[model samples]
Each structure stands twice: as C-alpha cells, then as structure tokens.
Target: MMTSRRDFLASAALLAAGLAVGPPLLAAPPKKYLGVQLYTVREAMEKDPAGTLARLASIGYNAVEGATYTGSQKFYGLTPSEFAALLKQNGLLMPSSHYRLGEEPTNGAPTLGTLLHGWDRAVDDAAAVGAKYMVCAYLAPAERGTLDHYKYVADQLNRAGERCQQAGLQLCYHNHDFEFVPQAGQRPFDLLLATDEKLVQLELDLYWATKAGQDPVALFRQHPGRFPLWHVKDMAKTPERAFTEVGNGVIDFKKIFAQAKQAGLHYFFVEQDTTPGSPFDSLTQSLAYIKKNLV
Candidate 1:
C-alpha cells in the first residue's frame, strides 16, 4: 500500500478539508483487506456458525480470526477441514487463530514429539485450518504476577515457536493494557518483546495500547516488523472507556493505519469486545468507517 506522491496529492483535498483520510484514497493499488475476529460475535457464532460466517462475508469482511476451538478440537463443533471449507464458502481466510499456549516451565513442558501427537492439538488443528500464525490471546493475572513468571513464559514461548514452526506456523503473543503496567520499575512487556525476536511476534491491540497511554506508532518504531497483526478495536467516549465500534470511538485510526507497512501488518482484525447492539451491526458500522477512512 504505497502512498506515491501523486496519490498523496490527489488526497490532499481531503486532508486539507480535514476529512478522514483513509488508506484507499492516500495509497495506491489494491485496497487493503479487512478481517474481523469472530469472538466479537461469539454468541451468534456459538448458536449458528454457518449463518454467522455467511453474514460476515456479505458485510465486506474478506477474512476472520478464530477466538476459540476448545470443544473437542473442533472449531465451533466443526472439524478443522469443515471450518476451512466454511471460510472458503464465505470467501474468507482464517490466516490466524487464537490458541492458548502453556507458559509452563521448559523442564516440564511437552517434548517435541509430545507436542506433535499429544492431547493438546492446538497447533495441529490451527495448521489444519490453514492458519499461518497461532497467537496466545491472554495471560491470566496469575500467570504474569512476577518477572520470573514472564521470563519463564518467554522461554516457553520460544520453545512453542519452534514446535509451531515445525508445523508450518509462527507463534505470536497478544496483549491487553495490563502488560503496560510496570513491575519493579521494569515493564514485563519489554521482557516479552526482548525474547527470541524471531520466535515471538506480536498481535498489537491498538485500543489497549492507547488506553494504557502508550503510543502505538512509537512501539512500531521501537520494534519494526515485530507486529504482524493487530486487534483494531476502539474505546467508547464515556469515562468508563468501554469498548465500542471502530469509528464511533475517539481513536485516531486514520493516523495509525497510515503506519501499517512499518508495523509489518500482514492483516488486522476488527474486534470490539462489547457493543451497543448486534455484533453484526457493529461490524457493519466499523467496516464502513474503515473502508472510507482507515482501510
């Protein structure tokens, strides 16, 4: 998505008028594809996976990310192959899936062979659905209570990355605002980033990063290409700062989307943890805003 000088000039009118300068206008060639994390519509998906997916495709989503696959190694009760076919039928790709990787002590961690054939079929199933990246979605407060625990997690993630790579996938870590808090005057977030650079990629959540008072662009500058995915959620205007649809909130998405290349964005998924009404409706509103103003 290069912003050639000509395209930049063409978009100058919008910029001068202070209109939303979405990527489609400022950049050249093939418009960016957008995906939504299915968790945003978990209830609907849980009740009717097929119908939910069909609706998403119609709403202009070219891709999706799975948030859960916990029941019987099946994605929402469908086998990996079935899930892949469903995505294909909807004209979508599940390039990534959220999976919980144990940050256990390496000494007690699964052996390489165990990882391949053990009861923990996360990596295998994720691969089966054609996912190229497996992201650890959350770390319970108990799991990250201390620096040593985080270091142990880093070690485990490094080991897990090796296993994922063997399965033709990359392992990544997703974050919330909690990671930004300082521990003993040193941020554990830094320790995680300081881990095996090649082994650990980041799925940067823009809303959480901003809520934590950290600049998303600065993080990109600090660690180029380390972020391959993002959770493009927005915060409501209330003092509680609840989750809201993309353009409805106060986030400067247009500014941030402009830095996609430096952030090494392969794909980003719109994910609003809470919504005023139907998740599909929220998705529709977010998609419209993104297409016209952020891409």
Candidate 2:
C-alpha cells in the first residue's frame, strides 16, 4: 500500500535491465531455413528429377536452385510449364538457375543458333518456374584468360541483366576461384563488381572465395548491400581443399552473417560440391549445424 521512492526506483531499474536483456536470452536467432543446390545431387537428379525433388522435399528442403531443366521443356527435356508443375507438386520453389554465358547456340556453334537463344529460353522457363534470379554460373574457357576478356564478360552480363530486368528477375554471377586472379592490376571479380553493381549482383561462394585467398567479410564491407545470395559451404583442412559441410570447416559464418543486412542477403544455400558420403547426410549435417550455431 505504501511504496517508498527508493523501492520504486530500484524496481524500475530492474525492469529496464530485464527489458534490455530478457528477449535475447529467451529468443533464438532467426531461423535460416536451408536450401540445396540441385547440382549437389546431380546423380540422383539426373536419374529422376521429379523423384529426386520429392525426396529432397521430404528431407526438409523448402527451396531449390535449378542446375538443369531435365523434365519436358526440351531445353533439358521438360517444358517450362511441366517443370513448374513438377516443382509445385513436390512442394519446392526454384528461386535461381545457373546458365552458361557464351555457350549458347546462337553464337554460331554447331547445334543451336546462338548462346543468347538458349538464354532467352532459360529466362522464359525460369519465369514459368517462378525463379527470381538467372545466374551465370561459369565463364567459358576463352572468357577466362585475360582482364579484357573479363571486361567483355562483364559487358555481356550487363546486357543479360537488362533482359533479366525486363523479365522481372535479377542476373547474378557465381564466383569460382579463378576470378580472384589479379588482372589489369585488380581482381577480375573486383572489375565485375565495379563494372555494373546493378547489372551484376553476386552469389558469393564462401568456400571458393576463401580458397581464392580473399576475405569474404572484407568483400561484404567493400560492397555493402551488393550480394543478394551466398553459397554457405565449407572447405577442408587439406591441401586440395575439398568441400565440407557447413560449420565443419574454419570459415567464420557467425561473423559474416553479423553483416547480413549490409551484405543484402536474401537467402543462403548450403552447397557441398563434393560430398564425402551421401549428399543427404552431408546436407542434413550442414543444416543441423546452421540451426544450432548460426541461425
């Protein structure tokens, strides 16, 4: 009935402390739901894309990045509509696709008319499958030799990105170790970043970036809000630097993820290029680690 001013002040102080710390103590970090690149399970997928997708869904994958359209589209085999229906039936979402840049038929190769023709079909199929990104997964061998070559690649990427913009999708470049090599006194990757930040966003493969002797965190700092996605795989302690599941290697994901907002991260996919055992086992272990440590 009678409360002293001193007691009220003490209670208020305690309340403030609890308000400041209680939520963090009780609540876990937000869940980073796991995604798998279909490429990791290429063997299984090649055998049965539909069946493999069903199994992946059952294994708790909510999203997928497409590696090929092997259903009925004749691009692979599946029509765009058929591919979309298959994914929908299996409770999966395709958010991105990896396409080769200069390998399309239209550039006067053997079979197809131009590389861009296949790319156009890819964009149409990706749109049909509701993908948000069209990714240039790798550069051609000819395109990889020089800085001038990379600049040309960047130019091509800008053009592709314009098409992607018209299709309401973003074009992204997935890095490998080669891009880190110095060219024209700068890393080709850096040139690409500078060439067109809007036209070519990044899907930084943490493992490859580290293998290339670059710091992922520094890149994030240098290009704040440019990376939209990340490949959250790990590297082994060996000289060959084999692929390992997430959190099993030395990369500090906790530190990298601390700048999630600055990195413009929308989603991160767990990709083990070569698994030591079953792909499912590797992915499950990786996802479990993320759930426990970095989520």
Q: Pick the TM-score winner.
A: 1
lDDT for each of the candidates?
Answer: 0.75, 0.70
Pairs of colliding residues, candidate 1 = 22-293
Candidate 1 lDDT for residue 137: 75
> Candidate 1's residue-wise lDDT over 21-109, tens digit each?
56433433453568888888887888999999999989988788887753346788898999999989888888887755433223565
RMSD of each: 9.7, 13.7
Q: Candidate 2, 274: how far from true, in Å?
A: 0.9
Model 2 lDDT tens row, 19-69: 354464444434344577777777787678888888887877777776654
Q: lDDT at 185 for candidate 2?
A: 78
